[model samples]
Target: MIKKFVFTISIPIVLFGCSVTTTPNGKQVDMLPLISDKNRYLIVDDKNLSKAEKLENYSNQLSEFYGKQNSAYIRVLPRPSYQTNDRFTPIPFMVYEIDSNPVKIFENTMFNPNNVRITEYAQHDLRIPIGKHDLIIVNGLGNSRWFTKIDDVNFEKDKKYVIGADVKKGQNAQIFIAEYEIDNRFKVVEPEHFIIKKKIIENIPIGNLKSVKVY
Candidate 1:
């Protein structure tokens, strides 16, 4: 079973000095492009660009990278749509670790239903190496902070997957990790439901930390 916990503590800023490399197969580059400008995968955060324009840029970029047969595309949609009561508020989340390695320091963007291109936001598509990876996700709900893990995910190359959540008032959030078949345009056209693997819900915690270092 996937375990979860919540704690109220100040998040500390910790510097992680490590080298992240990208190969021609689009492994590390697609996963953490924000680590450096040399990685062409970095999204150009032009505030002047309309939401549609930003999405178009991402679409075009994804289409161009479709030939990378060694990499898999994954998008995390914790707040896929507007909530009934919290329409404008952000559901902050962070991918703290991947395959036992600490994710390099990065900024988390507010959930914007309009801007579809992958930002540090919860709804962006990320390219990652094809293999079994253990992931840790930290998310916020109201005044509490919680975390969960997706372990032993065997991602295949050239496939697209979406990890989304179903949250309700006075209920624990249910998360689904679904795989999809993409078209020539790199858009998710059909849902391969059988490809989905794990399903879990949030749980309450019994302890708190003075401070947490997520980076």
Candidate 2:
């Protein structure tokens, strides 16, 4: 099961000693990327990681007694009216999370409806609860939306996963799931990066997303 509570952290910018940049899509980037050995995969106390760093480690955090660790992202292929020539562009879809309780992972319609392109697509991924279970999903939008349940999805804490789907134009639109796991190195990106230039005079409240250190 994923952690049940939401974390409301007040980041006072000056804590992270690095410069921050934002992508056109509004994702954060660490100008001075953390230069770790890249071979070390260790987890420290929650207190050790700044709110931003902790959020960055959310997907890959290792533990014997924590929530199931799993991350998944969906891709969609566009349609060119009635043509066999696949219009491999971006299509908006929603990602619905269903366990005991049902929830849509993101408010961004593009991310949920699982949008993507052939040339560039990564930033849009849902870091799901880890463990051995099924990932129940619902894709598409408006009246064309439908349910898709992937059974026995073994989500290992160490191994990352990527799921791709092709949207076929039919009576409506149909999604052909899991075309490939493009990267065993499933796109683990820093969702946000902040560089603290100086200590803030007061506690600051920010929004959008948490700091992502690595991937």
TM-score of each: 0.43, 0.32
lDDT of 1 by residue, 136-187 (tens): 5555444343445566777777777666655679865555566744344432
- The prediction achieving the highest TM-score against the true structure is 1
lDDT scores in order: 0.45, 0.32
Q: lDDT score of model 2? A: 0.32
Cα-lDDT of candidate 1: 0.45
Of candidate 2, the 10-residue stretch with the lowest lDDT total is 199-208
lDDT of 2 by residue, 124-176 (tens): 33355544554434332222323444445544443333333323455333333
TM-score of 1: 0.43
Off by over 4 Å in 1: 1-69, 78-88, 92-94, 104-120, 166-171, 181-215
